[model samples]
Target: MPASKGSRNAVSSAVQQIVLSPSDADYLDQLIPAIKDAAHSNRTAQLLQGLSQFADNHESEIEGVCNTNHQEFVNSVNQLLQVREGTVRLTSEILDLNQSIQASTEKLAEHKKALVDSRSVRQNIDEAAQALEDCLEVLRLTNHVHDLLATKNHYAALRALDELQNVHLREVPQYKIAEMIQKSVPAIQKLIAEAVMTDLKTWLFRIRETSQFLGEVAFYHTELRRTRQKERAEKDPFFRNFKLNSAMDLVSDETDEFDVLDNDEVQVDFSPLFECLHIHEALGESEKFRAEYAATRRQQKDLLLPTSIRLVGDDEGGSLSALLESIAGFAIVERATMKKAFNLRSTVDVDELWDSMCQSAINLITQSLPDIDDADALLKIKGVIALFIQTMENWGYSVAALDSFLLTLFDKYAELLKQKFSRDFLEIVSADDYMPMPIQTSEEYEKVVNVSWYTPEKEQSDISFPCVLPFSQMYPLCCIDIRNFLNQFYFFSDDHFQHPSVIDETLKKSLDELLAQKVCRLLVDRLSSQYLGQIVQILINLEHFETACVELEQLLLAARSPASAGKSVALNATEEFRSNKKTAEKRIFELVNSKIDDLIETAEYDWMAPAAQTEPSNYIQTLTRYLSNIMSSVLLGLPTEIKELIYFDALSHAATMILALPLSADVPTINRNGVAALALDVQHLSQFVDSLGVPILRENLDELQQTVNLLQSDNSDEYYDVSTRNKKYGRVDPMNGPLLLEKLTQGMQSSGRTDKYTTLSSRFGKK
Candidate 1:
């Protein structure tokens, strides 16, 4: 009735390992009985008929039970199947992993075998290297032996050399070459000795450094020394405070220490590492001495470097410098201590230097002389002066160094200019090189003039020489100062001789005059032989431009007086009341007219008229309208608002004469005073004062003042003087019979007075 040992073992194992909850225990309790009963019933189905019958009698119950048990079994079987499927997959994967492990194990074994084979091969190579090294040693020994044999048995030594050559280590070395070089140049041996000494010094320095390092390490290993050093490093704020800084800060400032762990102290470099630098510095000092030795060898080798000088027999800075040194010695004794530094080649003769310089300067001066029309030469001279200044700068010479030369040159040029401009003017020239000169300005000039003649070298005066050169204005006039050769030729030209001036006087006059003379063919040009037009103009000024009447009276007075000069008269009928030059006339006339208009009160209209007229004499103002007509005539061919007036008979006759004469001739005209003179002539006229009837000179007038108011009278004769007196229009008795007769006869008796002397012809006339 107790469980078997195996079963008990299995149950214990299941409890520990199988992991079933209480629910699984319940399921198994129901499942186990159903399984057993089914097995038993199937086994005894024929034998237990009665039992079977009983079972059949409760078949429904049994069937229900079977159904419940079967369902429970099916559920249990499905869960078991899923668990089995998972176990199968896991087992298959384990089998595959085991196979992979076996294959990897085989490969690892093969690699281990290969590694062993490689190690063996490497060992063989190491043995072979040793053999090769031994062979090289033998060859080196044989070479040494061969070298000894070379002197005694040369042929045998050659045979030994052939054997040595077949080996790997018989190649040439620098030591042998150095030995050969030493035989030729003993200095090479000295160089080798020095190199060996340097290597020895390196080993000695290394030993000293190792001893010092060991001593330092020993001191640090001891507790007391270590504590002291650590204390000192801590106590010194500079090293003690040293701590981690950011990498960025260390990069920005080299002194920043990210980890200042380096144990080296700030002290002079010592031993092998620093000894190498010291050796290099020592060698550098000897390089100058070696260069001299090299120069000597270079002579034997016949080598040349850049910047070398060539000589006839030899070419060397050293040899040439040596020769100069010898010459300096000789010169010192013969010529009293040399004025310059020694050892310079005599490419140029010292004795001839001044002469050469002076001659070159003279040639330059001559070459720089300006031609009649040499622009390029002038540019070249300017370039030379620039070159001189640049040369002075390059030499760093004193201003006084150039002052004397400049003064001499300027004086010579001044003398040349004096000769050049002896008979003409000096033209001031300009240069494109307009930079301010270093030479004295006016202030400096005054300073120089005030300075003592014998000033110290440092205080030498800068004397400014006033210079002359050519100038070109926007326009060239005869007044322009003459230039060189062109001016020389001009001064001797025929026109120049006529004027006895150095320039073309005519060219200086004006383009207006030149053009007018050429165009008008006026009397200004007629004076090629002499000046008749100018004389005539002068005489006209003296005559003061009289009116025809005044001029006539003048001619008459001359005719009448024995004192009146005949030399000035030309019975011109000239009636030259015309203007002289147009500009002269226009300017003077405009100015005079402007002045008169400013003074006159009655000038409501323009002082001149728009057309030619010969009416409105001044007597019309006082006597007649003739003066206005004459003035208007004189202003003919003038500007706008200018005119001349004449009556129909006189104008028609004048027009005919104008047409008759050549169109070129300036027509005659009257003047202002002539009108006055004519009025005077009428009143107190020498030619025309009436003494008896039909005895005076002939005259006529077109217009008169309407003072009488005549048309108002019914009978002109009855209302004349008596009616005027009755009206009492004026102080005079105008209507008396005799007065009336006198008035009526006045119109007839005075030939100059018009018929309508008192007639009212105007729209606003009093009549």
Candidate 2:
């Protein structure tokens, strides 16, 4: 196989030489193995082996190039060593140069230190020299300022001293100069204070010498501002800050020596000057105002007093209404003037002026009251004072003084009234023609007892009762006076007079006492005598006694009632008047009762006449008629209980008269049935009066019934029989038990048939 491969290789080589020839012998030898290897079945391994041989050749060429490079690296190392040698030399040269520079720097610093020390020494010398010069200047200025102050050139001295202080050389020299200024300040201050004082005094003198009232000072000060504005019209007037104590300009110069040194501006107080500057002109003006006000008050008083009184009474005498109107008008003017003069115009703070003025007003009214002396002047005076008091109260001032004066006036007026009314009462009492008794005839008596007075069968004359004075005439005058008093002092009638704190109750008591003691007593004393007896007889005859009682009661009550009742004296006066009333009432009742008893005792019945005459016995009819007249007239306005008691007494007396007188010959003969019938009429009359619903009337009615019942049961002299037990028990008759029950039954039955309240029987228990 090798021989064939080698022949192939040679052939291929010859071909290859023609295609790609190999130049070396080894190359050919190597190519032949590669050809053989390629021709073999294992050509890959052969190709690899050829590549490895090529790599080895390449590695050999690389190693040869690396050797040439190693020689160049040696040359470079040598050059670097040469450069290192140059750097070392240069570093040495630099270090030697650094050492030389360091030596020079030390030398420069030493020179700078020396120069700085020399400069510091020169600055020190210059500062020391300037300070010495400043000290010299301070001493010179101090001496100069002291000299200026010695000459009292305060403004110049102050300037120089300020300049000295500004130097501030040393505290000692400055303090020494301040001491000199301090010592000189007192004299400088005195001169400046004198100048300021002169200016202030000039201003004050100008103000005080102004010819004006002190009250015009505020206005004058206003004028000062106007004058200043006009005087400096060309310039804007500097409005000074109006501090209350803006006198600082004057005060600052008036300083003590120590005060000057302690502060730049010494403070001085000018309050003493203000206090010393008192205006005597104000005192004079006040006195003048007082005199003027006093004169004005005098003129007002004159016009108010007699002029007011003249207005009250005309030349003939003014009417009450006109007098009051004038007094009130005067009071109004006085009040207004007093307030305006005292409160507004007068400068006096003293109350004496006002007090006197108030007193004058009161005095004017009081004095005017007594100035009236006419017959009716007293009444007019009272009216005037009342109007004056009312007017003053309406004016709303202090009324204590006026009220006090009024009390005295009222007392005096009351005393005067006592005299006037007493004299008037006495004059009328002595006059016989005032009230005369009328003559009463049998026909008049017959008419009175017949109960037919509305149309009397017999014509009767005018029947007049005797009176101390006709109440119709005199009493109206009293009413007029009372009405006048009340209307005049209307304020007193209000709630104000009731409280003792407001009005003097003692004065009220005295006034009431005067009326009770004088006026009321006059009426009572005059009315309670024979004249009263005559009046009572006439009233009883005409059955008007109850009317008299009520009139007297009203009069007594008015006398007892006073304006104020809180005082003990007023209470005592009321008690006295009440006692007088009771006495008068008792006397009046006694007189009327005596007359009634006489009529009852004299009553007689003419039973022997015809049946018509017997039907109403002359005695019984007369009694009943009289009683009817009595009830109709006297019991007109009496209280129900009083009327019942009166009627009971009249009926009881009639029963007593009938029971006491038997059916004897002295009386006209009458049958037992007639007596029984009379008894029935008596019972009926008793029942009629008993219907007034007074519990007391029931007992009297029951007694009357029993008396009539006995007269009917026993037609004998025992008609008024009193059982021993009943008499001892104060019961005069047996009770008419069945009769009363029968009457009550009839009353009830009749009441059911009639209106309950309107029925007579119903009036019994319902009332």
Candidate 3:
């Protein structure tokens, strides 16, 4: 656009000031759009006029700006010229580089082709080398496994076989040697397993034999240890004063006894067992191995139990103690073997194998129980079992099953003992002769006093030899039987009953009941109603039996365990004996009364005839002689008080018999002479009663004498006087005097003594 000089200069100055370099071209181009917009809108003149006014208004500022930017514009033109030169140079270099790159690419492709061909050969060589190495490794491992198997190193062979199959064989899958090794792997594994199982079987056999040897060794050591402990305890002062918690504590505290046998001589090899375990574990049959091991041991343990228990005295290991020791020794060895070899803490880990073993033993012992008849043998078995229980409990095994078995054994033993005692007592009593045991010599007396049940109240020196030996001195054969039975019983009980498991009180009670029922009561039932002399002897025997029983009761009480200290078991035999004694005494009196009745029945009186003699009747003489013989001989062993009682009672009964003779229905009437004979018999009876030295015996005899005296009187006035006077007939009723007078009158009339009878009747009847 044409403009003024100042405007043209402003425009030039603005152009120069804002020189459009390549970076400013965008700014100039941006302004071209606005300039074109103005031109197209027909605002070009107006735009020229606005620019002229802007150039005139700030001319100095625009010149200063131009002048300030003049050198910069010049530097810009030079830089642009330099840039153009550099651009031409760079374009030529780029063309040259592109041609070189194309040539290098073709050459690189040729070299790559050759390198690929060589790499293929190298890769093949590396693969062959790796395959060879793998084949060698598999062959080496296979040979090594065979060598291990040959050397019986089954566990190592199995491990090497694993490496060959899982790692080395994977490397050489197509190789013949690898294929052969792979095919043989199963056979090798099977061979290893079979070899391990064979070794295990051999180990089982060796263990079985070794267990027996070890059991015997253990038993020997246990016995030796017990002997040593006993010797030590005997020497120790404190042991005498103090008791251990249990006798089992002594054995239990010395667990080191097994250590003494852990030397080469006694130690068993466990290499085979460990190999079996490892090989089985590797073969994925660990559980099967455990089951097989357990089953084999269980079968072996079963074999340890006897089919039947041997009798105690039959053979070397026949005794209950020996058999139990053998069993216990085996159990101990087995327990230790399991704990050490298998790393098991207890038999509990193997499903309580030890308890199962004990059960087998218990069953065997129980099955043999019926054949054991001896109470002592049963007791020995029971003691052995109790000790076994204690030993097992100390070894950390459950004894509940064993404890139940022991209780059952105890019950059986108790019943057996009771039956034995009962049979013995019955036999002794049944065969006993009802006679005083003859102790004629001092030696015999000493033997009697020395019996176990004969605990004398006084010293032997102080005791005198009685005419008849007391029951304490075994006066009867049954007493000796009692002594023997008690001796045997206490011998069995002393050690057995002291054990905590036994109920001593119950056993003692059973014994008491047995003695009462089988001995004392038996004696009473069999002897109380026998003859008087036998009854007398039984009474004496019963007295001694009571004394013996009292002593036995004391012994039982003293031997009782402390747990039953509050309980008391009084022997019923003592009371039964005492009662039997009383029964015998009464029975003796009854027998005497019966004899008197028989004698009285044999007496015959002639009431209507004249008196034959002035002496006593034959019956009275026989009665007195019989009584004298009994008092002097049969009742001689009886105490003086009892003898006197029997004498007085017999005499009084005789007097009663004589008094009843005249009133008997067989005597229709008594003549004066016959009455005189009867009065004479009464007088003889009174004399005999007076001689007995018992005033009570004389009373009945005196009454009989007074009645006979009244009948013997010739005067009717005397009969009237005796009947009216209370002093004359103090033992007789005064009101019966008329009846007595009338009977006398009738006798007189019957005998033709009418004068005397009429006077007696006239005098007493009217009164």
Which candidate leads the pack in lDDT? 3
Per-residue lDDT tens digits for candidate 2, residues 367-472, read: 5666544434544444444444433343443457655765665455545555655565455434423232232465544433342112322344443422112122
- For 722-760, candidate 3 gives per-residue lDDT tens digits of 445456656644544445556656776877778856765
Model 1: how far is 107 from its true place, Å? 99
Better of 1 and 2 by lDDT: 2
Candidate 2 residue runs with Cα over 4 Å from true position? 1-407, 417-479, 490-507, 518-523, 526-588, 603-617, 656-698, 701-730, 733-767
lDDT of 1 by residue, 715-752 (tens): 44434455554563333223322232233333233434
lDDT, residue 734, candidate 2:
38
Task: Evaluate residue 744 in candidate 1 and report its C-alpha lDDT on the 0 to 100 scale.
Answer: 31
The C-alpha lDDT values of all candidates are 0.32, 0.43, 0.66
The candidates, ranked best first by TM-score, are 3, 2, 1
lDDT of 2 at 658: 59
TM of each candidate vs. truth: 0.17, 0.32, 0.69
Q: After superposition, how far is residue 646 of candidate 2 from its true place, in Å?
A: 1.4
- Which residues of candidate 1, in runs, are more than 4 Å off? 1-340, 343-355, 367-372, 396-767
Higher-TM-score candidate of 2 and 3: 3
- Candidate order by decreasing lDDT: 3, 2, 1
